[model samples]
Target: MTEDEALELLIPGVKSKKLSLEDERKSKDLVKMLGYLPLAIDQVRGFLTEAGYATSIDKYVDVFEKHKEKVIKPVGVVPNAMVQRSNLYTTFELSLAPFVEAGNEPALRILMLGAFFGLAPIDEAIFLEYRKVQPAEARPAMPAQDPWDQIRFRRTVLSLAEQSLVKLHSQQDRFAYSLHPMIREWLRLRVDTNPRSVITWRPWT
Candidate 1:
C-alpha cells in the first residue's frame, strides 16, 4: 500500500475507555490465531533445520544428532584447501618475475601474503596459524598496511593498474584494489614457484 493508504487504514487509537474494548478484541484475536502454535512449531521445525540439531550421523553417513535445543548440529566445515594451494603455485611463474624486476617490494609482499591467505581476501585460519614471521619481524623498516603504508601500496596499485595486473574498486568513502585474473593466476603459482626467484623490489640506498 502507498503511504497515504496505510495512514488511512490506521485507527490512530485515542486514550480513553474505548481502548479496553479494542485491546480485548485484539487479544482474543491473537489467542484465537495462536491457539495452535504448538502444531505450527512442529511444522516449522520439521520443514526447517533449526540450529544445534544433527543433520547427519557421521561426516559420511546420515546419523543426525542435536547440537542444542532449537539449534542445529554439524554446521561446520573442515579445512581442505591444500590441493588448491599446490595447484596455484605451478601456473603463474611468468607474471611474478616482472614484479621482482620492477622493484615493487610492497606490492609483491601484499600479493604473496594474499596467496598465503588462500584465494580469498578473508584471512584464512590456516594462513594465520602458519606465520613465517610477524609483520614487524618480516619487514621491520617498511611501514605496516596503515595510512602510511597506503603511500607505497597505492603507488604499487597504480603501477599494477597501468599494466592491468590489478583493478581498482572505489566507493564514496573507501577504496581497494584486487588482482586481475592474470595476477590472481600468478599469485596462485606462488605455492610451487622457486622461492629464490621472488625478489624484494626495494632498491639499495
Candidate 2:
C-alpha cells in the first residue's frame, strides 16, 4: 500500500493474504497434482488422436435427435470429448490422425527424434550411427538390443509418413527418411524469432 493508503488502513485496518503452515503443505501437494495435469492431457491427446478424427462433442450430439432409453440419465449418449473440440490440441490431432493411425507409438517417437535432429535426411546407416547406443551406456529400451527389430525401425518410418512430415523411401538394402515440407515451411517463420539474440551472436556478419 502507498503511504496514504497505509495511513487509511491503520485507521480502518485491512486484510492480507496469510497462509497457515498446513495450508502451505496442501498448496504444495495441489501444485504437484496440477503439474501432472499437462502431462496427462498430453498423453490423452496423443491417445485420442491415434484413436480417430475427434471433433467438438456438440458437433455430433443433437439433443433433439438423441433418444432417451430406459436409463434415468438417458441411454442415447454422445461423448464429451466428441462434443467440444476446437482448441490447438484437438485441431493438431485432427490434422495428424491418419498418420497416427497408420503409425503408432514407435512411429511417433521416430518422428519426434527426426524433428530434434533438425529434420535431417535419414537412412538406416545414418540412423544406425545416430540411433545406435554407446556400448558403455546402453539401456534395454534402446535400439541396439535387437538390430533386426523391424518393430523398432518401422516406428520411425511410419510416423514421418503419417504426418506428411517426411518423405520415406526404401531400397532393397535400406530405408531412407527425409524432412518433408512441414519443417521447411515452418523454418521460414523463425527468421526473427530470436528472443535470445543476445546469446545467438555471430563471429562476423
Candidate 3:
C-alpha cells in the first residue's frame, strides 16, 4: 500500500490535516517495514492505539525492528515455539487460538491440509475426500455410519473462512479456497517442527 493509503487505514475517521515532516517520514518508514500488508498494518495500528502510542509511530518502528530479525526467521526451525513471539506472528496465532481452545480439531485439520497444498485455490472436494479416508482419530465427530457426512466438514470450512485463515471462492456451482501467503508460511513452520502432523503435497487425482 502507498503511504497515503496506509495513513488512511491507520487513522480512520480522522480529518485531513498536514502531518509534520518528522511524523510523515516516520509513517512512511513504518509502512515500508510493515511490508505494505494490510493485516500487519492493522495489527500494528491496533497495538499502538490500544497502548496510547498512536502518535509514536517511530517508537513502534523501533520495537518492530528489535524483533525484526527473529520475525524473519523460518518457523519451526527455531526452538521453544518462539516463532510466535513476534508481534505479527502472534497476531495470526491469536486469531487461531480460539479454535484450538474450543477443540475444533476438524477446522484445524482442514486448515493444516490447505496449508500443505500450496497457497492457491484448492478444490473443496479435496478436503471432503481426505476426511473420508482418514482414520477415526482424524475424523470429526460426525455420524459414524455416515461416511459421507458433510455437515461437520462444511461448518469447519466456513469457520475457517470467518477467521480469515482462508479465502473462499465460488466458480459455477462449485467452491474452492486459498490461504494467505503469510498463513501458509506459519503453517509450514508448524508442520516442520511437528513430526506428527499429517500433510501431503500429492495432487488429488
Listed in order, each prediction's TM-score against the native is 0.34, 0.35, 0.56
lDDT of 2 by residue, 139-158 (tens): 32234434557655766566
C-alpha local distance difference test of each model = 0.36, 0.39, 0.61
Candidate scoring better on lDDT of 1 and 3:
3
How accurate locally is residue 153 in candidate 1, as Cα lDDT from 0 to 100? 56
For model 3, how does the per-residue alpha-carbon lDDT over 24-132 read when each residue is reduced to its tens digit?
A: 7777776666556677666666656655765478766665665554444534245244433344565455456567768776676667767767756887676557656
Off by over 4 Å in 1: 1-97, 116-135, 138-147, 180-185, 192-205
Considering every candidate listed, which one attains the maximal lDDT? 3
> Runs in model 3 with CA error above 4 Å?
7-35, 41-87, 131-146, 192-205
TM-score of predicted structure 3: 0.56
User: Order the candidates by lDDT, highest first — what do you get?
Assistant: 3, 2, 1
Query: Of models 1 and 2, which has the larger TM-score?
Result: 2
Off by over 4 Å in 2: 1-93, 97-104, 118-120, 130-133, 136-145, 184-205
Candidate 1 achieves a global lDDT of 0.36
